[model samples]
Target: MASLGIVLHASLICIVLLTFFSGTASRNIANEILQRLEMVEKLNFDLKKENSNLKLEMIDIKGELKDIVNEMKVWMKSRHSQGNNKMNESNSDLQKENIKIKLEMAELRDQMDNVVRENCEMKKKWNELDDILISVYIHLNKSKPEIQSGIMPEHRTPLSYQHVAENRKANSVRSVQRIVPPAPDVTEQPVAFYAYMDSYHTPGLPIHTTLIFDTVQLNDGHGYSKHDGVFIAPRTGVYVFHWTIQTEVHSWESIEIVVNGSPIGCAASDTLRINDYGTGSGLVATRVNTGDLVFLRTHESISGYLLSNHRLRSSFSGWLLYS
Candidate 1:
């Protein structure tokens, strides 16, 4: 009974050990399968993500293609429009060229016709002139030679008549010569002091006198004198006096002068001073009337002073335009 009991206990112990080992192996197998299933699930999730991304990229590509197609259509339409415009322009230009050519041809034809007409007219005129010239020549050739010689028949003249005619012609020529006055001497007034008295003056006016001095002699100290001034009645008139003073020095002051007292005409003074020794002029213009006196005043004192080759000349000429 003791040996049997020992066998039974050992048997029970061995079965319990076997059962525990089998359960451990089964647990390991189950864990390995579960790990493989988890890996597969992760791979599927990654594939789904990749597929979604690819779909989005495809949509973008399709949109770009649509834009390219639209742009192509627009470019084609523009090209077609441009082609139509070019064709119309070409047709219009051709019409204009044709019209211009026709107009030019018409103008040329008109010019040719005008030239032909003028040529005919000129030829006709030339022929008529030629005929006239021929007739004139023939007529001149037929003229009498004796008449051309200026001779007359004796019956046309008497000796006494001829003598009287000649005498009358001589008398007529002499009469014509007498009627025509001789030319007044224009030779410059004698180179000397010329004086005119008021005796030849008009009434109610101071005697107007003109004195022309050929030259002023500084050596003689003869220039302006108090009494030299002219007296004219008081009246309104344009008075002009010109005095030309010539000197050897170009830079001389107060060479020519004129002075007027009360009721004097417009008074003017002119002086010419050049840096070079040449011709210079001085002028004075004044309006004066009756009882007015004008005189020449000398400003410079020089011993060698003498009127230039032209000589010192003083002239007073004026008329009373109004009283």
Candidate 2:
């Protein structure tokens, strides 16, 4: 019984010790699990904080990217606008150049037309001159026989000359007629005039009123009237006319040469520059009938003094080019 009791006591002690060890081990495992849970929670919290920080940084980066995109858009827009403006300017310049070229081409065409007309006129004049030369040759050939015979033709004597010869001694009259040559050829008289403004013409000359050249330098054919400043065409002919105007400082004047109430030429003098004198001249050629009136008149309202002096004289001159 003692041996059995000892065996049971040993077994009881082993069981108690095993139970305490088991309890202690369970407590340690529970504590270790709690520590592991706390560590895991801390790690999760740190990860979450890091994630939040990363999110904030990503948001900031996104905002910066958006601002950069907006700035790039603005810069690109400005560049596009500048390019468009340059293109518009180039287009305008091209348009201006095109217009200028068109005008130049028109002028060239006008010059060509004038040249063609002048060539045709020259050809006509040459044909007429050839006809006149042929006629003159024929006339000379017909007069050759009479010239060789050395006899005066009957047609050469005037009726009054023949009567006078009959009343006088025939020999003496014949001798006098032989000594005298045929009458000289008569030539057409030339028509020309030149005049100047001898006095000052103040401002406010009425529009369309005639401007009188008070001094006459030349008045051949007596067609120019200095008092009235008019030229009456002496004969039917083509005439050339020229006029000059002078203006004082800061003055403006306009004039036109008129033929029978029709404007033929015009000129203007503007001396708006400081202490400057302005001068203008006009020239025209036109056909006029006998007794047609030609004069100078104001084209527009005069604004300043019309200066005429020894150095600079406003003058009018005209001449018959052909009849």
Candidate 3:
């Protein structure tokens, strides 16, 4: 019975030790499980935070993409506007060029028409002049033969000249003129005139006055007007004019040849003693058109009175040199 009791005690102590070790192992395992659970919860929270940050980054990228799209649209719109403007400018330039070309062509046509018209008129005048020359030449040719013959029928006298031969005695020679030479034609010559101051007396004004050529002693073809004291040219030509003035003693005289109230030349003279005369003369040759005026005027220095006697103290002479 004692042996049996000891064995039972030993078995009870083993059971107690086994129970202690098992409890200790179970507590360690429980602590390990709590630490692993804490690790997992922290990881989940970090993952959620990372996911929120990624969403924010994606939103920023989307905003940047939208801005890029807007900028590209604006750039494309600007390019389109620029292209339209350039095309419009080119079209406008072409239109202006077309208008300029049309204007130039119209002007050219007008100038060509003027040239053609002028040429036609000139040709007509040339043809008329040629016809006149040919007619004159033909008429001269027809009369040339008759004029060359000495015994012409048109030139013979009605009564024959045989009686003059019977009346002629020996050694008595008679001069018989069969043909009379025609006198030269003087009508085509230019008209000329020489006039003298008829009424030469004291000047009415205090100063010198215009020299009035009252009497035209030699007015050929009435070219000079006596009342107006002017010489009116009949045709365009070169004319020579002269004027002379004579003043009494103790006085000075001056004269000028004037054209249309403008003096072209002047002459001056002064007397030295009493009863003496001062002579002033002026001569001019000028080209004048038809209806030009020419006259002589007394200068301002010519005072008192002018002298006119048998010698014709004051005289004006003019002649047309050419036409």
Candidate 4:
């Protein structure tokens, strides 16, 4: 009975040890599961925050884009209205001048007709006078020897008639000439200009660099300089500046528009897949003094290899609002 009791006790102890080990393992597994749940919740919260930030940024971007579109539409309408007004005024003046020219031409034509008629009548009178002088000369010649033997042929009345006919011809010829004044010179239309420019892409850009655009498609009035990424304000006014950047797969970048060494705005993009693309852009309007400096900067997070410089990929643009 004593031996049986010892064996029973040993079996009981083995069973107890097995049970305790199992219990500890189960508790450890439960603790590990709870820790995993908490970590997943934290990750979810962070993702939610990032998503919220992205949504807000998208909303602000949409608002800004809408505002810019509206402003451009309004500006275009005003310019078109002004052009139409100027064109209308010019057309009115041209029509008035044309009407005046037609009137003057009509008056000139009437004067010319009168001159022609006067000339024809004077010629007819001169011919008639010449015929009468000829007849009188013939009659006087027939009686010159009997009526007045002292009268010379040079002193005959035909000579005076001839002079009178020549004078009438000269007067008619002089009256036929008319002088017309020249038309006024027409002025050319001026070219319309707006302060705007666009730049794109750069190769071999160092890490965490102030992106200096080397190529320029358009720069009016020398506002943007390709030498440095700095945009010099030509006038004291509100100006809008915009920029875009592209990143390689599994890469990210933060772009900021800095005015006079201070950041005005930022936009960032991230891509998680290999060989994929991420693009971002930002716009800002700031009141700037003349000669103020402005440029785009790449944040330190994207200080690695930058995959930019494609057709219209990474771009910068600026324009003045009012001066």
Best by lDDT: 2
Residues 216-235, candidate 2: write the lDDT tens digits.
89876666765456676655
Ranking by lDDT: 2, 3, 4, 1
Best by TM-score: 2
Candidate 4 Cα deviation (angstroms), residue 297: 99
Q: What is the C-alpha lDDT of each candidate?
A: 0.39, 0.70, 0.62, 0.58
Cα error of candidate 1 at position 264, Å: 88
- Across 1-323, the per-residue lDDT of candidate 1 in tens digits comes to 44355546655655655676577765565555556555755676688789999999999999999999999999999999999999999999999999999999999999999998996786466446534533442343234353234332333222231243244334421111101111122132111112222211111111111222322231111111112222222223444444443334323323333333222222222223534333334444555432233443334332222233323332333223333
Model 4 TM-score (2 dp): 0.40
lDDT of 2 at 154: 42
Using TM-score as the yardstick, the better of models 1 and 4 is: 4
If scored against the real structure, what TM-score would every candidate get? 0.33, 0.42, 0.40, 0.40
lDDT of 4 at 276: 71
- Comparing 2 with 4 on TM-score, the higher-scoring candidate is 2
Cα error, residue 296 of model 4, in Å, equals 99
